[model samples]
Target chain A: MARTLITVPRTAKRDEIIEIRALVQHSMETGYRRSSDGDLLPRDLIRRFTCRFVPRVAANSNAASTAGDLIFAATFHAAIAANPYLSFNLRATTSGTLVFSWEGDNGLAQTETVSLLIA
Target chain B: MQPSTQALQKDDTQNPAMLWVKDGEALWNKPEGAAAKSCASCHGEISRMKSVATRYPAYSSTQRKVINLSQQVNLCRVTQQQASQWPADHESLLGLEAAIAKESRGLPISPPTQRQLADAQKHGEALFNQRVGQVDLSCRDCHETLAGKKLGGNVIPQGHATGYPIYRLEWQSVGSLQRRLRGCMTAVRAEPYTHGAKELIDLEAYLAKRAAGMKLESPGVRP
Candidate 1:
């Protein structure tokens, strides 16, 4: 699994705007540079990141609620430095799960889930 | 350092070097080598090794010489783990060093007071003052005499070794103090000593003494 760090509060007041930070380890090689041996380095990068919110559903509910609402997203480019870090704000309304995903070259896909309680 | 860069280093979430620290934590616990032992088997949790980085470039009785932390680490790999030594400045090695050094973050640098180590430090002091290379400049010339002066677009910093395994912006990666020292030698058109050389270890010893009492900021972000 790709090493990652995510910062989110465990609880927040209703309608409060909370900040969430996410960082992932990646080289994000641009493929432009050449090695000391003179060979071109292959491009490797984290291309996209997204966050989703899924409201808690009652137990025994037969709802196939797979996809969650998109909360934030960004598309990265070659210029992005190694170990990309991003922060965004979320309006807390209800208790739910936050899903974070990173997609990148070299089949790099990682997902992490965090639950936030709204009081 | 720019305020923005300082801000980056201040926030653990923003500092890229933390990634290596995290990886090092994992490596510390995970089993490896013929002995099927992890660092944790002998050292326990990484946090338990706190304040260890402060007294490095220490004298070694077994080797009858002064050694830096990296050399000590490699010695463990060879004698304890029965594993091959990690090549100089290898990513895995850097990760481990960064992780280990992070344990001592905020602690004062405290070089061990051993006769052998003190001798090494004296030797290193001579090296720091000796003029070399086509530039004919000693480390003291710029780091002491010309510190804070602009060289090209950058201001020279007072040479201190309070941080190692720092995340340098120029390299876009975490690097060791030896790497930085080698770069400085190259800048002055001097031939750098080989990694793990006694001269480099002596320099490390002197730097540790020079930076004594200063807080360590391993995995420091430098521009």
Candidate 2:
């Protein structure tokens, strides 16, 4: 799994747009490059990234559902550099957890979670 | 530097080298080796190391030579911490160097000047002026004479060491000043000294002196 870094505010006022930033370590190798022996290096990169917010569990619920509304998403290509860094804003509606996930070539997938509190 | 590169350096969140700095913070506090001592055990809080990087490539009486911060770290590892030396360009070494250099941010570069170091300093000065390799170009040719001029669509920087452990867009990673020097030598088709070699140390000393009074900006982002 690629190393990841995620930044999100712990608390924010209702309806405020909070900044969210994330970075993931990957080679993002383009297929055009050649190896020392002249063999072409295969392209490998994080192809997709998604962020969603899971709302606070209801009082009657035993567990919070896994699904949530998508906050942000991006599709990447070989042009992206080694570490894909992304920053975006989120409008706070309620206290919840922000889940970030990335999918890439060679079966690479990574996810990170951060909590957000509504004040 | 390009505006985009400068922006990356100014914003910690945008600087990719911050990832290594985070890793270095962990290594600083984590104990290892036979002595079970971490860098923190000796150096205490990293804040105490402020401006330390600027004073490096200074004379070391114990070694009877000038040594850079990376060499000092290795010396401490082997002699004090009872750990093996990290290989050249090792991620752990680069991480620790970046973390240490980060502490010295905004401080001025000030290499030592003492009677004993005068000879080594002279040697370094000579090396900087001497032309070699197929291109036969000296450091003065570009950095001193052609500074601020455009070359191959890129501005020629004075080639100061102020921003070492820099995140070069070309490298796509953080690297040391010595590594940059080696790259320059290779560009001129000159033979580069081995990592940790005395010649490299002397060159570093001279560069540090040349950059005196310049602000330190390690883990800097550059194009």
Candidate 3:
């Protein structure tokens, strides 16, 4: 499984361009890891990721538990790398915050927060 | 004192934690890679980090979440050591944690106290009791009810923190509370959680509460 380690600036000028990383620890078992019976494990991966910018960016991940604030979200299909890694560059132009999160076949949850400067 | 049970005896012989802890110990002293900043570079001395693991599973206000020792170490690697995470269950990760926990052995296992801790505990307890899958078993079924009974070829300990980040024979490596929980959920055919997650954080609160007052023994050897 890939652990998502996110990094963003502590403070950014309003509308300042910032970079973000979103990754997940996932076996991404493509119907693998079968038992002695040899049954397929079932396909699990980030299918696609949508990066939306509202207050910051709205990300709709096929794996996201919910949709909102999410600056970047993506669904990883079976082909995505194990512990899928995603990164983004966005402009922070408002007093709101930038949200970073990921979704996976296992479960769609795990988030890290970064505050945007209101300058 | 000669080791008693197979669990105890097994540890002295082929302890994965010991193996990883040794690596961690080595990493502590020998600096390598680009910048050549060994962990000891900023930490100074092992003795100085006294009781460090005891306060772990603590809240990281900077990151705005609760994190354990292993996660904290990984964070340092990315931000400070200029390294990346060694796979979720990677030996390097477990070993690094074990080495740190080994240092805190005997220090009290204290849970963190922040405004949100209580809420986290509430969420944790809820999740533990929620029955899932065909077995229709909640974590409480085995851990709370048949806690001491032998199941799946091993005596289920009280799930204490006295020997956390402990080496496990099954894993062939040291493991965190989150790792153990994920395995259990998968066993019951429930959806498992990721390495760093809210469920893990909540469960940390509940388990630490269960093991409160017990000394922390990082890099602990287990069967």
Candidate 4:
């Protein structure tokens, strides 16, 4: 399993800027390196990361119509270190769930979600 | 240690070794082997293991020998979980060791004073001071006498085992104290002891005593 650690405030005041941190485990193996037997090690890495905020619908509003706002995204390359970590700032405008996903080589895809409350 | 490297170790998010610690935590609670028992099944909460790492390279009555944390882990796996022993420096082994040691973070190194452990420590001290290998240099020559001085591009820090299962940039992974010692012996062109060798355990025992009262920083990030 590709384990990940994420940090986000459990609750924040409206419009407050909060820091979010995400760390994911991966070898991020570069294709250039040769094995001890001199065979080239194939490249394996997480190629992309994205975080989106799915805003909570009001009691009277249509939940199905709610939309997710893209908060951050990045494209990782060979130069990125193993167990990549990314930290970003987000404005707490509404109560919502933050979705984090990673897509990578070898058909790797992982997604995790954490809830947040804006008081 | 350089300030930047120290900073890297201090932050959990930036430290790559923490990935192993996280894996270890998961392993602690997950069931394994025929009995389907996890470390938590018998040990209860992970917090129960706190301060346990401070006393290691301990004498084991069952094995009738001195063993380090990794050996103790294997013992539990075989005896309690009925699982096969993990090879030395295996990711799962390193992860479990890292997780256990992390619980003792900020606690002093407190090697036991049992007679068998004492013997191992003494032997280890002698080995540390003895000249060996093609270069005819002992560990003391560089880690003790020349510590803080430059050797090529790197500075030789005191040979303390305070932080282990350390995340060495060179290795690009978490490694045990035994693995690091083997690397050093090889660097000196010495016929290095095999993994889990008694001599290596002895060295680890002595280093534990040598570093007594120093705080542990397992899963340490090193340059």
Q: Which lDDT values do the candidates have, in the order given?
A: 0.90, 0.87, 0.66, 0.92
Native-to-model Cα distance after best TM-score fit, residue A86 in candidate 1, in Å: 0.9
- In model 2, the clashing pairs are none
Question: Which has the higher lDDT value, candidate number 1 or candidate number 4?
Answer: 4
- Give the per-residue Cα lDDT of candidate 3 at B148: 83
**Model 2 lDDT, residue A15, Cα:** 98
lDDT of 4 by residue, B59-124 (tens): 998899999999999999999999989999999999999999999999999987799999999999
**Measured by TM-score, how close is model 4 to the native structure?**
0.95
For residues A1-119, could you state the per-residue lDDT of candidate 2 as single tens digits? 56677878789999999899998767799999999899999989788999989999879988777788898999999888888799999889889899999998899888888999999
Best by DockQ: 1
TM-score of 2: 0.93
C-alpha RMSD between model 3 and the true structure: 20.4
lDDT for B171 in candidate 4 is 77
True contacts kept of 4: 0.35
Model 1, which residues run further than 4 Å from truth?
A60-64
Which of candidates 2 and 3 reaches a greater DockQ? 2
Residue runs of model 3 more than 4 Å from their true location after superposition: A1-119, B1-16, B32-34
Write one digit per residue (lDDT tens) for candidate 2, span B1-223: 8888899899887788888787777789888789999999999997788999998888888988788899988888998899999988788888888999999999899877775566667788899999968999998899989999998999999888788888888988878888888999999999998898888888888888888999999889888
Candidate 4 lDDT by residue in tens digits, A25-71: 88899999999999999999899999999988888887543448889
Query: Model 3 captures what fraction of native contacts?
Result: 0.00
lDDT of 2 at B22: 79
Ranking by lDDT: 4, 1, 2, 3
Please give the RMSD of candidate 2 to the true structure. Answer: 2.1
